[model samples]
Target: MGKITGFMEFERLEEGYRPVPERLKHYKEFVVRLTDEQAGVQGARCMDCGTPFCNSGCPVNNVIPDFNDLVYRQDWKDAFTVLDSTNNYPEFTGRICPAPCEAACTLNVNDDPVGIKSIEHAIADKAWEQGWVQPRIATIKTGKKVAVVGSGPAGMAAAQQLARAGHDVTLFEKNDRIGGLLRYGIPDFKLEKFQIDRRVEQMKAEGVTIRTGVMVGKLPKGSRVTNWAKETISPEELRAQFDAVVLTGGAEQSRDLPVPGRDLEGVHFAMEFLPQQNKVNAGDKVKGQIRADGKRVIVIGGGDTGSDCVGTSNRHGAKSVIQFELMPQPPEQENKELTWPYWPYKMRTSSSHEEGCEREFAIATKEFVGENGKLTGLKTVQVEWKDGKMAEVPGTEKVYEADLVLLAMGFVSPVATILEGFGVDRDNRGNAKATTDFDGGYATSVPGVFAAGDMRRGQSLVVWAIREGRQAARAVDEYLMGFSDLPR
Candidate 1:
């Protein structure tokens, strides 16, 4: 517990952000972190709940109450120790996680939830500021080698943990940069690359060897994470070279909207457009930048990717921007009694949505109307949920001018190269087939080749990817050494 009656004393403090006008001008992060005094007050709001559901609610199982109490007591060192005990990378989660812990806060039953994520952001940012974050290399060497495929959160977390466990860890990334989606798929405006670079340096100091520009398995001549892979190694070769291999390449197959004029020149998968901007922000001059400048941009899909596209388009100074969602608009507020201690269903308006843009819900894209081998407009119709299915309203069909069409509909599965090369099984959802049991957890169908993260679990948050990676590292360590001390 924090302050005896802190919940009654301090109100929840939401993280601040720069206004859209200021933030959209540059491809950099503009989120305002909580002040030290504010963080301390918010930390004090943690109650003496017999069961801290926030801990369980978090995918990474972050120790919520312990750190809250520590920060409240002004014990900075101990707070970080507690925080790093479970989450391998708080910085990543602080920026990208949805913070389900806030939803599960005990105080949320009646009052506003403790500012758990805000406090976490402050703590992690402060730790970095004070140079408190450093390498935690082991004193003893176990003489074991582990290879982590993919440099996303899951692979990065597992590599760090396994290396600290006295193993020689080598992390392989198909991209030129270490972070997989974080380095490419995600725009820099949301998360600055420096945050990832500093952490990567720390991991390197901890004896984790990151091998960027290296793809695994028998890949096509052009298949790579980004536009950067110097060499390709097969799965059998990796198994022969390393003691154990972990597959965490992530689900990269973009779900396509197969409709008329899908092959138009201005239409592209969101990944193709988003990554180019990220590379440009990283100071790499992409020959052909997929830009929305001076064009009527239309983003399809309503989730995080779509929101990201909307924000990116605004930043690009598009002529006009619009987003379409097939699902009906959800209620603004959730029924607390029915959804307490669990994530609730409600309308989520992101920061990108706050920026100037037209959003239409309960509408389905009928087709892409193109001219002269280019997308000219989009056909749409009003939709309603009827008899457990979406039915279009008659006479509600409409068309809107669009020069650039970005399909932000989300990913379907991991690319088929490595899975097929290793003969790894796949689930019905097209993710890597694996179990989460204490015994042989995260082990892939192919022996000596394990799987974790988005590649294993399909599309999910960065926090969940880190959790899977950390747990998979523990499993791999146990399998190698019979007994291990790595945490899940």
Candidate 2:
């Protein structure tokens, strides 16, 4: 610990956001990161607890205390070194990841947890600004070739690791752009696209071959999920060329609400709506773009995706935005004594919510009401838990006018085409079936195929994707050379 009693002397300080009015006019990041002094102070707040629960709490098992001490001592480079050792993209996680590590912090038991995410953001940004982040080109070329399907976080991490391990790695993406979900799913106001661009450039410098606009497997016919592939490679051809294949694509199968009027014209999946805005932000033209402008928008689902819809709707100058959550609202605060050192169930309000969103909890949409094949409104009912199931309360039916309905429900599983193409086994939930065993983990039933991230574990956080990617790289490395020195 850099300062034994420093925790007692400092209070948590959060990063600031630009004014809502000014930020809504453009799709750019509004978060004002912590300055170096503020980050150092935040680092000082890391207590000298014997067990660093935060390390275990983080998906990648980052060396939290070491980086906190390094940051506290103003050793920015070493702090970044420690951070980079674990996370491939601190910039991505620092911006969007909900810090589970903070919830598991010792201080969170009674006091505010150390601002680990903010500190990591500062360190990552400083590292980039100081040119500390550069290409780690391999000096030795191992003769193995690896194919990474999907250019999202997991695929990107795996490709970079295998490339650095001296293997020829080619990352394939269906979209015209490299980043999978991050390139399209997330709004630019939360995470700028340039962040991904720089990393893509770095990966290229490290000898990873990036092949965008290339689909290794077919997408379902007429699927609305983003795909701009100009070329297609059969699974057999891919497997023949690469010594190992890693499936790191996201779970693109969005859960749908199959109520009445689901065929309405203005009704859409969050994926269908989100990617268009991102493409527009990237200067790509989309025909008949779904806009929330002057529309009464109803976003169903209470997760991050729903929050993103709210934000994007506000940016579109929507007339009104309402978000519905099927579950009852969680308590504003969690009972620390009972839930310490673990993620807590509590009310979470995003910056988007604060920007102007009427959130309705314990509410379920009964039916989408429309006329002339266009969404006009929705019928809803107040739900309550009876015994162990949600039951609609009597006399609680209501209707709300809405011009656009965005189903922000989370994804159920990965698209079936890729798994079918590879002939890989699927778990009960339809995710690619694989184990995380140290000896031969991330390996699918197929001999040379591996699966990781959302494709293997279902939809999850970016940090989890990075962890899976790095570990999968190790598994592939060992499979190729009969030994691997890569970190798991």
Alpha-carbon RMSD of each model? 1.5, 0.8
lDDT of 1 at 425: 97
* Per-residue alpha-carbon lDDT of candidate 1 for residues 220-322, written as tens digits (9 for 90 to 100): 4554335477888888888888999999888888888998889899998888889889888888899988899999999999999998899899899999999
Among all windows of ten consecutive residues in candidate 2, which has the lowest summed lDDT?
A: 219-228
Clashes within 3 Å, all models in order: 0, 0
In model 2, the runs with Cα more than 4 Å from the true position are: none
lDDT of 2 by residue, 1-488 (tens): 75788889989999999999998999999999998898899999999999999999999999999999999999999999999999999999999999999999998989999999999999999999999999999999998999999999999999999999999999999899988889889999999999999999999999999998998889888776778899999999999998999999999999999998899889999999999999999998999999999999999999999999999999999999999999999999999999988899999999999999999999999899888888899999999998889998999999999999999989999989889999999999999999999989999999999999999999999999999999999999999999998999
Q: Which run of 10 residues does model 1 get worst, by summed lDDT?
A: 218-227
